[model samples]
Target chain A: MATISIEHASKSFGATEVLKDISLDVKDGEFLVLLGASGCGKSTLLNIIAGLEPIAEGTIRLDGEVVNDVHPKNRDIAMVFQSYALYPNMTVERNIAFGLEMRRISKAERKATVREVASMLQIEHLLARKPAQLSGGQRQRVAMGRALVRRPKIFLFDEPLSNLDAKLRGEMRTEIKKLHQSLKATMVYVTHDQIEAMTLADRIAIMKDGVIQQIGTPQEIYSKPANMYVAGFVGAPPMNFVEVDLVKQEDQFGVILPAVLKGEPKNYFLPLPDSKQLETRENTKIILGLRPEMITHNAFTQSTNPEIECDVDLLEPTGADTLCLIRLAGHPAKARVSPLFACDPGESMTFSVDMGRVCLFDGETEELIRL
Target chain B: MANPKTLPGANGKRYLFGRLFIWTLLLAAAVLYLGPIYVVLSTSLKDLAEIRAGALLDLPHELNFTAWREAWSSACIGVRCEGLRPYFLNSVIMSVPSVAISTLIGALSGYALSLFRFRGANIIFALMLFGCFIPFQIVILPMAQTLGYLGIANSITGLIVVHTIYGISFTTLFFRNYYVSVPQELVRAATMDGAGFFRIFWHIMLPLSVPIIVVSVIWQFTQVWNEFLFGASFTSGGSQPVTVALNNLINSTTSVKQYNVDMAAALIAAAPTLVVYIIAGRFFVRGLTAGAVKG
Candidate 1:
C-alpha cells in the first residue's frame, strides 16, 4: 500500500477550469471517497490519481516518490469504470485474465487468480460467456474482477455501482466493502451519492466548484459540519436554517426570533445562556442550523428556555420516522419525529425545540459562528 | 424476431399472404436487375449475325464460342486487333495492390483518428474527410502530372499509385467512423492493462472489427475495380486497364461494333467484384447496420 499525495493539482479544458488548486492526501489502505455533484471535479481528481488525466499544475507523489511523469500502466494502478468496459470479444474469464496476461504471468497462475476473484464476486458461472451475454450487474463484476486480477498498488473506482439497479447497487456496495476489508488495499472511490460516501469512506472529501468544503470521517462531518454548504449537503431531508437576531435582554443573551406576535410576524425573543460574544452582538443576524432529528417531538429539557414555539405545517411520513415541516420564527423548518408522535398534515402541534443541539452561523458571511 | 402468436393479423392465412406478396415483389425485382446480365451472357454465346440483329431479348439459336475467341485474341484494339487478356491482367495487377495498400493505410489512419487524441488529430481528420468528399475530376490533372514527374508515367505501377493515393481518404473515413462506434472504454481498459497503441489495436480493436474490415474491402474493391477515368488518363495502349481496352474495342469508327464480345469483356471485367460481393454480401449489410444504427 502506498499513500497518494496530490499537491496543488489543477486542470483546465480550454477556458473551463475543471479542477483548481485541489490537494488531497489519501492514506495507505484508506478508502477515501471524493464526494460531489456530477461536474464537481471528483472524477477528474480520480483520473489524475490513476494517471489517466494530466494536471495543469503540481505534482503527485506515490510512496514519497514523485510520479507525475509516470505513465498510467507503469504507475501500477487498476481502475473500474462506470460503464464496466469489458472486452465484448473476450469471455469473462479472459477479461479477468487480461491484466495478468499483459503482465506476462503464467497461464496456470492466471487461471487460479481468475477463479479466486470470480468466486469472490460470485461470478463463477459467468466465466464462459462474453460481456454481451451477461446482465448489467454481471458485467460490473467482470470489470471489478479485471481490476482485482491486476493486484496493483492502488485502485480507483469511478462510480462503480452507479450503473446497477437499486438492489444490485446495495449488494455491490456490500461486496466492495468486504473486498476492501479483505484486501486492505489503498482505494480512491469517486461518487456523487452522499449515502455511499457516508458508508464506504474512511475519510469523506465533500467538494464543490473544484474546492474541498470539508474532509473528515462520516460522523465528524455529520455532527460538526465546517460551513453552511457542508451542513446542507451531507444530511438527507437537509438541515433547517432560520434568520434570527442575537439580542441581550438584561443580564442574559438570547436569539431574537421572528414570530407572529402583533399582526405580522414580530421579532420575539428567546433566552439563551449568557455568552460574552452573544451578549454584545445585538441587532446582528445569526442563522440557526439544526438537523431534523435534533428538533424532535421529544421534550426540550436540556436548554434553559425554548426559543422556537411553532405549529406543524406539513407532515411527510418516511416509514419509521415522520418528517414534519414547522413555521418557527417566521421561517419554514423541518423536524424528525418518531411514528409514535406522528400527527395529521393540518394538526395544530407545538414541538419543544432543543436549543442545545442548534448551530449558529454568521448570516452575511455564511460561516459558522465561533460561539 | 417476432412470435407467431403476436404476428400482425394474428392469422396463419394473412401471414402466408404477406410472405407470398413479399416473395413475388422480390422475384420481380430480381428479374429486373438480372435481365440485362442474362441477355449479355446469351449474346456472348451467340454468333455475330444474331447479335447484329439486336434480337438480344430472344434466346440464341445455338451456343457459340466465337465472341469469347475474338474478345480474348485476334480482335482489333488498334492496328493490331489483339485480345483483352493483357488488359484484364493489367486491371487485376493495378486494382489488387491499390485495394490492399489503400485499405491498410485507411484502417491504420482511421484507428489513430478514432482512438488517439494527439494535438492535430482533429485537424487531420477534418482534412481527410474533406479530401474524400471532393470531386475526383477536380484533382486528377495535378495528380497525373505529379505521377509523371516521378517518372512512372505510362506504367501500370503509376496507375496503381494514383489509385491508392485517391482511395486513401475514403478508406480512412470508413474505418474511422466504424472505429468510432466501438466502445472507447475498451481502448482505455487495454491501455490500463499495459497494452501499447498497436498492441491494443491488433489484439483488441482489430479482432473485434472484422465486419468493418469486410466492408472496407468490398467498398474499395468495387471502387478500384470499376475505375475508368484514372485508368484511361494514366496509360495508353499496351498499358491500359481492361476498361480502356473495352473502350478501344468499341470506339473504332470504321470497324463494326461487336456487341457480343463487348458484353463478355464487360462481364469479365466485373467478375472479381461480383464474386467478392457473393462472399461478403451479408457482412457488408451487417457492418452498416451495426456501425450506423443507434442504440
Candidate 2:
C-alpha cells in the first residue's frame, strides 16, 4: 500500500478553476473519502490522484516518490468508475485479466489471478458473461474484481456505488468496508454521499467550491464541524442554526432565545458554557448551531440540562425518532425525540436542551466559536 | 370503446372505404416501383426474334439463355468483345480496397476525434466535414492531375485511390457521429488498466463499432460501385469499372440495337449491389438508427 500526498494542487478548465490550492495527505492502508456536493471538485481530486487529470500546479507524491508526471498505468493504481466502465465487449474474465495481460503477465498466471478474483467477488459463474448481461450489483462486483486483480498500490473509486439502488448500495457499501478491512489496501473514494463517507472512510475530507472545509474522523466532523457549511452539510435533517442575542447575566454568558408557547411570546435565556471565546462576544449577536438530537423530549433528560417549553409547529415521524419543528429565536428548528414522546402539532411540549453541545458561530463570518 | 368494429354503421362503412383507398394507393406505388424490374427481367429473357414480334409487356414465348450467355461472354463494348467479366473484376478490385481502406481510416480518425481532446481537434474535424460538401465535379480536374502524377492513371489502383479519397469524408462523418455517443469513462478505465491508445481502440472501440461498421461498409460500397464520373474520367479500355463498361455497351452504335443483350448486361452490372441490399438491408436500417437513443 502507498501513501498519497497532494500538495497545493490547482486545476482549471479554461477560465473556470475547478480545483483551487488543495493539499491533502492519505495514510498508507487508510480508506479516505473525499466528500462533497456536485461541482465541489471531489471527483477532480480523485482523478488527479489517479493521474488521470493533469494538475495545473503542484506536486503529487506516491510512496514518498514524486509521481507528478507518471502515467496512470505506470502509477500502479487501479480505479473503479461510477459507471462501472467495464469493457462491454469483453467477458468478465477478460475484463478482469486485461491489466495483467497488458503488463505481459504469463497467460497461466493471468488466468489464475482472474479466477481468484472472481471467486473473491463471488462472480466465478459470471466469468463468461459480458457486462451487458450482468445486473447492476453484479456489474459492480465485476468492476471491483477488475480493480482487485491488479493488486495495485492504491485503489481509487469514483462514486462506484452511486448508480445502484438504495438497498444494493448499502450491501455494496458493507462489502467494500469488509474488503478494506481484509485487504488493508490504501483506497481513495470520492462521493457526494455523506452516509457512504461516514460509514466507509477512516477519515473524510469534506470539500466545498474547490476548497476543503474540514478533514477529520466522521464523528469529529459530525460533533464539532469546522464551520457553518460543514455543520450544515454533515447530518440528516441537518443541524439547525438560530440567530440569538448573546447576553451577560451576572458574569454567566447566555443567549436570549425568543419563542411562542401556547400562542404567548416568551424569551428563554439558555446559558452557554464558560469560555474565553464567549466572554469576549457577550452582548453581540451570534449563530447557535444545535444538532437535532441535542434537543429531545423531557423524559430522556438530565437534571443539569436546561428545559424550554415551546409550541410544536409540525411533526415528522421517522420510525425510531420523530422530528418536531419548533421556533427558536423566531426561526424554525427541528428537535429529535422518541416517537413515543412526540406531541401533536400546535401543542406546547417541554424539550430538554443540551446547551453543553451547542455550537456558537460568529454571526458575520459564520466560523464556529470553539469552546 | 372506439374500436372500428364497434363504431356506428355509417362510421364503420367510412372506415372500410378509407382502408380500401389506402390499399389501392399503396398497390399503385408498389407497381410503379417494380414495373421497370419486370420489364428488364422479361427483356433479358427474350430472343431477338421474340423481341421484334411480341409486345414490350408480353411474356417471352420461351425463356431464352442466349442473351445471358452473350452478355457474360462476348458483348462488344468499345470494340472489345470480351464482355463485362473483366470490368466486373475491375469494379470488385476497386470497390473492395476502397471500402476497407476508407472505413479503417475513418474509424481511427473518428475514435481519436471523439475521445481525445487536443488543440485544433474541432477545427480539423470541421475541415474534414467541409470536405464532404465539396462536389465531386469540382475535384475531378485536380484529382486527375494527381492521379497522372502518381502514374496510376487509367488503372484499377488509380480508381481505388480516387474513390478512397472521396469516400473518407463521408465515412469519417459516419464513424465520428457514432463514436461520440460512447462514454469517455470507458477510455479512462482502459487507460488505467494499462492499455494504450491503439490497444483501447482495437479492444474496446472497434468491438463496439459493429453497427457503425456495417453502416459505413454499405454506404461506401454502394457509392463506389455505382459511381460513374470518376470511373469514366480516370480509366478506359481494360481498367474501366462495370458502370463505365455498361455505358459503353449500351451507347455503342451497332447496325441494329440488341435490346435483350443490353438489358442483360445492365442487369449483370446492377446485380451485386442488389444482392448486397437484399442480404444486409435490415442491418443498414438498424445501424443508421443505432445511436439515436440511449439504451
Which model scores highest in DockQ?
2
Worst 10 residues of 1 chain B by lDDT: B286-295
Please estimate how well model 2 matches the true structure, expressed as its whole-model Cα lDDT: 0.91
Predicted candidate 2 versus true structure: per-residue lDDT over A49-135, tens digit per residue: 988898889999999899999999999999999988888888999999999999999999999999999999999999999888899
Clashing pairs in 2: none
Give DockQ for candidates 1 onward, in order.
0.46, 0.62
Q: What is the DockQ of candidate 2?
A: 0.62
Once fitted onto the true fold, the runs of candidate 2 whose alpha carbons sit more than 4 angstroms away are: B1-4, B7-11, B292-295
Error of 1 at A173 (Å): 0.8
CAPRI classification of candidate 2: medium
What's each prediction's TM-score? Answer: 0.89, 0.98
| Minimal lDDT window, size 10, model 2 chain B | B286-295
Could you tell me the lDDT of residue A232 within candidate 2? Answer: 94
- Model 2 agreement with the true structure over B1-295: per-residue lDDT tens digits: 5687665664566778988999999999999999999999999999988889869999887899889888878989988898889999999999999999999999999889988867888999999999889998999999999999999999999999888888888888998899898988899999999999999999888989988898899889999999999999999889999999999988983888889999999899999888888888888899898863231
| Per-candidate clash tally | 2, 0
Give lDDT tens digits, candidate 1, residues B1-295.
Answer: 7897887787788778998999999999999999988988998888878877777689899888788887887667876677788888998899899989998899889999988867899899999988877787987899789888999988999988988888899889988998887767777788888888888877787777788888888998898878888888879988999888888877752557678888777777778899999999999999877873121
